[model samples]
Target chain A: MKTLYVQGNTWLHRLSPGLKLGGLAVFSLLLFATRSPVVLAAAVFLAGAIHASMRFGVVRTWQQLRVILLSISILTVFTLLLNGPADALAVFLRLVALAVLAATITATTSTAEFIDTITAGARPLERIGLVKAADLGLAIGLVVRFVPEVLARYEAIRDAHRARGLKQRPLTLAVPLIIQTLRHADEIAAAIDARGIRGQNNRKLGEGS
Target chain B: MATRDLVLAALFAAIIVALGLVPPIMLGFIPVPITAQSLGVMLAGVILGAKRGGLAVLLVLVLVAIGLPVLSGGRGGLATFVLPTAGYLVGWFFAAVAIGYCSERFVGRSQSALVQVTGFFMAAMIGGVVILHGLGILWLAYGTGTGLSTAFLGDLAFIPGDILKAAIAALAGRAVMVGYPLLPQRA
Candidate 1:
């Protein structure tokens, strides 16, 4: 997985993950509420200014944004045909502002920090017994770890196919990948059970009751 | 959820992201691509059943919300939420729910093999195609201002690919049925 986090100790880095995430949400809301091209354009400028503040340099900033830029361009072009230039501009400006602002924060914030913030945010629900905040953290952690494992497994499966002289199609790739992972899932659940990681929640619930 | 179920959900979420590494075929008319990830969504539902399946999709969305580029084409962040494809992306959750629920209700330990395959196939179509496309088209038409008929026509491009995915999910569900029986046994 490509990480957006860059090495920096800027003020954006100093801010809490909650603040950054909250601002991102509110910032999106602001973009959604406005129709004026002026406001939209300014939002774009604001996003640009934030990126410039990073001093990631033009190359680095462009590197981060080029893919997003392509899709945004596609949408803008399509909208131009369907809805005319005005809506097209609106579409482009809004996506740029949102994507840039989002990319900036993500670059500054590490995945650990992001997951921690989400876990903290879900604390209230934990208190009400709707969920275990710790399990939320655990689940996110497991997913973050599992993505790479799945990829590695995919590579191994491809290798196995190569050695066996089998043609690799999408279905062939997927079937083995899924079955192997599901088998691992059984072991993983057993491992978790052995370690008592998830059981902590149930034990706590029983104590509370 | 049980430990096995949570781990299973997380595992499926990982599979969804991995499937995304397969390059999506972008349609000339529509903004969204023909992604392999949706096939992962169908598999999650068919294999994991409803509760765990929906949880898997939700976990991915949470990853998306924090701006991880887990979507096909390395696109993530709030930018994706505003994309014309956002409708389908969000629709993934409901699609998984619909498929998983139908899988649970339709297939059983004692069911005939034909019933098992047919049931899983029907679930995938209802969830992966009907439910997902219904929401996806509506959002494209209204949210993106593309209008209904044009958007509907443009979305027709996805049908052939999506049907193939539904079939694959059904067959895989059948293949793995005996090994992993997630369907409830009635308490």
Candidate 2:
């Protein structure tokens, strides 16, 4: 899995994973509620401070944000053309602040801690029979881990196709990826079954009896 | 249904939510902003399969419904669905189902990366892009009082990004199967 979480020791890092996640959620809500540029600016400043505090390599953070920033710039120009300067600037700043804050959160928190927090938080929802929060947490962790791995595989396949001078046909790319994923799913299922990790409902029934 | 499977679904849902945290870019010509949420949706289907995949998507949608502001560009609310993008929001359920169904039914434990990729694309197109965009365009047409041609033109910008999302979904789906091999079994 391509882990986006960066390891670090900072105030933001020291904060409980649940707290940080909650803080992000709350702060983001505030931004949406007000839509005021001043509040948004304040939020952005706070986010930047936290991001800077992480002190992970400044260059790395910048690199990660380069694409995002570029997109924002393009968007600003386009929006300005259509909606005029004021609205464009407001949206642009809001987006930049939001992205920075989110990345800051990602940079400071470890994937494991984040997953734990989410699972712990979501556990209550199990009462509604919607899903077992713990199960959702584990699923989130696996998906997070899986993202980068999948991206890397995609690059390799694309490169192979390029090397073979095959046109970038969707079929050429799509079919193999699907087949490979199914195989992986099968293996994973078998592995889980072998370990006796049965359904949660079943486990609960066994426990209750 | 298995513990492992449920865990995987939650994890994928988280990934989808995380991707949503990324900011979106607004196009001048269209009201719909470009976002990473669709990529997350694509991943959900490809990784989680149809049934569980849809469930995973529901997990994220539930978060949004509860006012977590988990959508792309930090936009979230019950009312958010009333906007033009509402159709796409509703389409996610179907997209996840389509993506999962195709992967499990066609790809079927073969482990061929190519086949998985193909399945991912098919699922995403049938579920995520085509179905999603189809609904979105209709909504846009009706909501904005524009013709189908105009609505489609507005939606055209998303096609490239949606395709890219499909590719990423395929790659991520295959990698999980290979690396973890402990993902939950199909229900």
Candidate 3:
């Protein structure tokens, strides 16, 4: 989904997806473990600095963050109401910092890099018959391709409902949506079957047995 | 796994992400928006069964971890795992398994349509509402530094919407059962 990825060729874009993901994990863990507002504030500034260094322009970064920023803002009000200004401020800073830092990585890395890295990383588990790297990669690729298509279908369905002057009842929307999506899945499964992909898996298992 | 299973898992993973694009129905009481993605979780379980269903959700989580904005409200990345919603996200995997296991156990091929629908509804409620909310509230409290009781109190607002989702999941599950009968017939 383009909503998920922002294309760019900064220094951050050059790093391997594995390295980028690992670093993001460590950074998030540290943020979660630290409760201090000062540390979180500094983290926010550091995250911002990293984004600025990319020269990706603040506008695009903000564009990627519009929904998240609104969410954090709404959450800030709740935290303020439930806890206090100190907690609210800390929560806001932490969320903003993490979201921005994450946006930086997503903006830089390509989806292909992500899938390849995941497949490579999981290749080690093949020893136990628990991993099939190629299949895993293909599955991830299919998911990426289908998400937007499904979303478009959802819009079409919703439009149809609206045309009929149906109330925005979730039940009505969900029933048709679920049926259509599952039908699509069934077709894909049938297509795979026709392609003889499952034949390979069956033969491999037969040989192993 | 069969190639069909792999394709179904990926397809359901896409379904989960697609559900996130549905604009959340807000009730104004809770901070969390009423999103349709959770229904996708239930459907995955009901349609795919336990092992395949869990893998389907795990696939989505993997995509999210790699920084795809597949989550509701368009939020994703490693950062989401640290947020107050992290528990629900993590729970999605187990919830799928739990619901699928329950559905498979309680709703057999010989069962009547009414019984099958009831079974699906029960499975959805147990896993999607109870298990998911249990994990979600715990994480929300831990992440936000709120007391467990308070966090749970806040989560109460979601019950009404979640009940509706369970009902919808049940209806859809029954429809799939009649229309496609994807579950393998008894040996």
Number of the top-ranking candidate, with TM-score as the measure: 1
Residue B119 C-alpha lDDT in model 1: 95
Point out where model 2 deviates above 4 Å: A140-168, A198-209, B3-50, B55-94, B98-154, B159-187
Score residue B30 of candidate 3 by CA lDDT.
46
Assess the local accuracy of residue A184 in candidate 3 as a C-alpha lDDT between 0 and 100.
67
By DockQ, the better pick of 2 and 3 is: 3
Over the stretch B110-187, how does candidate 3's per-residue lDDT look in tens digits? 888889899999998998899989998998888777679878988898877888788878888777767666544211
Per-model clash counts, in order, read 0, 35, 0
Candidate 2 lDDT at A77 equals 65
lDDT (0 to 1) per candidate: 0.81, 0.63, 0.78
The DockQ values of the predictions, listed in order, are: 0.44, 0.13, 0.46
Model 2, C-alpha of A101: deviation from truth (Å): 1.6
Q: lDDT tens digits, residues B114-154, model 1? A: 89999999999999999999999998776556688877887
What does candidate 3 score in Cα RMSD to the true structure?
Answer: 3.9
**Compared with the true structure, what per-residue lDDT tens digits does model 2 show for residues B1-187?**
5544554565456556655653453434445555656776877777677877898787776555433446665554333443344678888988888888877776656557788667767777777788888888897555433457867876898787787667666766676666555554364
Best by DockQ: 3
